[model samples]
Target: MMSDVLKNCHHRWKTLNQRWSLQTRLLYINMLLVGLMALGISVAYYTLTRYDKKQQSRERLNIAFKIMQDDFQERL
Candidate 1:
């Protein structure tokens, strides 16, 4: 099964290789690499921003809790 898959891929690659020129293949490869890099960067940025938001929310909650504790202590 694995050999069959490899044979199919080789056949498709040969067909595509014959259809496109060397320069066109290089350009296509470059565009694919750049697109992949952009996607990776965007994912990283999204993850970092989400983490920062969570940290900020936690900090705000802690501050509010401190204030409430102080108020309760003063009343008692």
Candidate 2:
């Protein structure tokens, strides 16, 4: 089943190659690759930014808890 699909895809690619010049095909393929790469990079950057924000929030909470503990100790 997979082989049939692959063969069909190959046949279509060959048909396209015959219709379009090689340079045009390569240019389109390159553009697709660059667009995918840009999308990946943007996703990675957003993930990292979210992670950094979470880490900062956790650190701030830890500091607040530590300050409260110090106050309790001083009162005791």
lDDT for each candidate structure: 0.99, 0.98
The prediction achieving the highest lDDT against the true structure is: 1
Candidate 2: which stretches are off by over 4 Å? 1-11
State which candidate has the highest TM-score. Answer: 1
Give the per-residue lDDT of model 1 (tens digit) for 1-76. 9999999999999998899999998999999999999999999999999999999999999999999999999999
**Candidate 2: tens digits of C-alpha lDDT, residues 1-76:** 9999999999999898899997998999999999999999999999999999999999999999999999999999
Candidate 2, residue 41: how far the Cα is off, in Å: 1.0
lDDT of 1 at 43: 100
lDDT of residue 7 for candidate 1: 100
What pairs collide in candidate 1? none
